[model samples]
Target: MDNYTPPFNQSLPQTAEGVPNKNSLSSYLPIRTKGNDFDFDAVIGLVLRGLLRKKVEGYSYEQFVADCQSAFEEKLGEEEFWQVLKEMYFENKDIFTVSPELLLFRAQKGEFAAGDSRVASMFTNLLQNMRVEEFEAKLNFVEREMLSTLREKMKPDSSLQASEKPYLPYLSKAFREDLKFLASRPKYLLSEIESFLSFYGFTYTVQLSLALVDWRSGQEPVAKPLYFIMDHERASNERTHIKNHGYKLFNESATRLFPMLTMLEILQPSSSEKGAIKVPLWEISKGIQESKLTHLKERLEKFARAFKSQRNLDTVLDESDAALDWLGNVMKLALAQFSIGERFNINKRYVLEVEKYLASHFIQNRGRSGRVLVLNQDYIILLTNLVVGEKDKLRFYELITAFEQRGIFVDKQTEQELIKFYERIGNVERMSDSGDAVYVRKTI
Candidate 1:
């Protein structure tokens, strides 16, 4: 595989060709774990650190305990300080220890869920210049300022520094725009703000996964622009037409891992193409799934030759009508290093796990289809707040358009449901009986 060169429209890693090149498929739609649940706070911490582009330093529990002791031991007795600390951090006070480091520090392991890396990478790439004021406002003064002081004081002493920082670029214009919209708002320290970020992260990740496409027809491969339809959580099963069609499309696209990788390989230019492409989100939706079957077949042949052994190469090259067979063949060849046997289900190995990854966050099983894309009330409210931004409110239709630009779609029935939901929550203002006159206000 290392020695093989791709055909004109196909690709492998373009390491020697240029800067800002994607090393693997993970660069485009990063899913590094086989199957693991996300830890939201850990993901937030990692993303915050990446956004700063600073040297990472750990703050030990021992140092944290000592700092607390020095600051509060005089004001409150030593025993009282320990009691307060235990009450604040742990539900079980019996686990408290005198040295204090063992409680939190001993359980430290640097492991994070697979999606966490993808989320953090995508976030940092999408948001390169986060406003300091907004960050501080969101986290509040104590979390921002005291953590800074404590980190500076307790930072590990090490001469070694990162040799080089990685160059991760934004892969989707839609995501970049939406993230910028969210960041532009005044950061509120409301309790619901944490839920907003958590759901936003999950929604964006699922949208990216569902909208991804690999275009192999042209001389160069291209990532087809992203868009997806979503059903309101309360949407009726019989009334939904566009939402059902959108779900069918989403289900088909969601399990495609190889095409995603192919798109990444194609998009990774020798030189950065950041300035080369800038199209309105509406213009991009027209180009989705434009790749020809013949082109995909040709790319598959090249992939089989590059990765398969002599015995398996002929087997993979055999003609097939099923897209699943083709994908399974490619997965088997590309992942041949893992020595996957012929009897094992390839879809379970490479495809189904992705669907499983999106389980409760972006997908639900309430509909007849078992798994369908859904936007619940909380996410809609958060999205509304961000889209409305500093404005008092936006025209209801315009707000819907903004949601579409961020790859979220709703049908007429769903839109009516959304308006009612907002109205019930007292965030919607109606000028008249028509949907066009309704305005959506920011919840924050």
Candidate 2:
């Protein structure tokens, strides 16, 4: 996981030219014109007021529109009202809570860049009731009851509410000594009282369950709520950073690789391992964002021309020939998402034991009958075979574990698909009960 922080922290301790103002709508709202003077500023001001006054709760889109209309005393048309609200939302986003319906709509419709959930959560958290706050409040209520009971020297009795009844004896010498010890600790030592009260988040349940926490074993129950909020905020900020600038480097490389790949996809429509597997050109395209489609047009043309002009006919292209296929698709996706650099390097050698497989009467299965899901599953098996050598064999569990360790998975549904492929090509055989074995064509 990335350390949760803003992505663009290169700027000095000052605001740059176009960043949003944390407290004001000046940066977000458009300036009003002279002729129509619709008093948007006044409307927005009142809307902000209503939102802050009812900040802890939310409104449906209809309720929100009606409330704004009632509070501002304006009868703008349907189009005009929504337009006004949209402008206000942009300008006062930091302070104002947009309806969840609108947030979800934007996120779903791709209006939100990368459609990241954390960005939605950051906005939505403001409008929703937080559970942790209630948990913290319950702990505080319990502590107060316990303290008051002790001060009054009340005896433990079934008649009192459980919260009011102190668990520790009020008049005991041990209780006084414990209080004295707590008082003697440092100024920030009030958290020590968590021990006196069983402050854990879980506890003894009655007929009706009450809020409880295991306070004695962990951090103070009262403080857990604050930690939860802070942790959530950190994660959200980290995701926002990733979504905003996560693709900058790959986009640059995609620019470089696009034209070269375009030529390669046409020239070689199947996997590079000499007819091992055939995948169509479009699956590779679906693996990336639509934004990547037109990103490096100008630069890629120059590289594409050079790549074609200087090409050698006998030169092996490796699996990148399937740039629009699964082999090319997975590699491109990894580079686009996981790798970061300016240069686009296109060199792959996926088929290692080509002669051995071919000699054993196993030609690459060029019959295309699967999607990206199946292609990758078979890819894991083939790559595993290369590492372990076809002469030796690994157990099914060991093979799957190896795949997982290398960030690949041979899922349960894909098991039969792999079995079928191996059955078609006899060198890779299932050892009946052993689930392990290798055979050279007919000689088992």
Candidate 3:
């Protein structure tokens, strides 16, 4: 009996077909029966201890059973251990649960504890029996509590009635951080503006309208709650300036202020169909305005200036310029096509016209003495003007053709050669066929 040590650590033998055999109670019974006189209570205690420890240690089902066997043999003799194990196994099979902490603990320690399959099956069945609305209500309750806490943290200085609590509670952690940052800031920061814009769909009508007024005046607004200038001097000034300057001051001003306005609008509470506060927009705005947001406005403005300058250039002379110009053009063309109620179809030769116009301008603007054409800051400014006009492909071609038709003599051979060069180098495909012909293959 003393010599009958079980093959505890040995790898199980494989079947004749090479599949490994599973361990069974009968396989260990011989070693259990052969052990010397065993103490049943001590064996039970050891088994329980091993099981509990294994539960903490996160042992797998097979490893757990093996642990139980080892504990039993160390205390009770092999014979009585099986009887005690059998009794306990049948009595308390249903009372077990695993917590997230316990799961994490086991994972950290590399313990492979086997969960009760029967318990999981039953729990899943219970969940399956619940209605979707019941589940949603439970989730909503949790969300409501979370939102209430957030609303309290975001509360404005003014007193709020009990009935005026915010309805939505499911804000992302980033949004909460943005709110706090905005609340700390003395003035609007880019992060706060960006976050607010993201919250809403980036539409800020009130701010846009107000900015239009300021742009016309070429000055900042005097106070908040800016009134719309219907027939004001500023409006007249803006109209005259835009007409003479070939650019809209109002548009430029709107672009500059758009982000902040967008943020404010998004942070505002949604209004009910009956014009009641579904959530107070002012409260949200107040919190954001108070927060100290990270300032990226300077960097953004620099980038915008560089971008605008690049847009004005005829041909990108450097790799960096080329990449920037390509991106800007793509965006511009996409926006222009979208605005014209076109789904990027080849219904009109708009893009081609623009390219031709640019090519003609590039030729006409070159140095007359056969010198290397230097694309300076002035050239970039000129190009910017061309881009803003949103000229179509046919118009651009005509512009170029007109320049060539004049005595400007833009090396016709070079111009033609360059046209072919652009067509080949720029992957410019001509869609001669009608009705989405350019994208028919793409759709397929």
Put down candidate 1 lDDT per residue, 1-444, tens digits, no spaces. 223222223333222232222214445334543544566555554544443333233645555556655555555567765666546543452322221112223222364555665655545545544422223233343234334434454323222212111121232444445445544442432234346555544444545554333222212222322323244455345644544555555555554544344333433333243333222111221222233334444544444454454324334445565433444465444434333454134433544565555435666665554555676677777778767876899999999887765656676767777888889999999999898899999876
Q: Which candidate gets the maximum TM-score versus the true structure?
A: 1
Model 2 Cα shift for residue 368 (angstroms): 19
TM-score of each: 0.62, 0.18, 0.16
lDDT of 2 by residue, 333-427 (tens): 32342223222222111011211211112112222311011123233333444334333665656664543332233334344445555566654
RMSD in Å for all candidates: 9.5, 30.2, 33.9
Let me know the TM-score candidate 2 reaches against the reference structure.
0.18
Computed on alpha carbons, the lDDT of every model, listed in order, comes to 0.47, 0.26, 0.26
- Off by more than 4 A, model 3: 1-58, 90-287, 292-444
Total colliding residue pairs, candidate 1:
1
How much lDDT does candidate 3 score? 0.26
Worst 10 residues of 3 by lDDT: 24-33
Ten-residue segment with the worst summed lDDT in candidate 2? 201-210
Sort by TM-score, top down from the best:
1, 2, 3
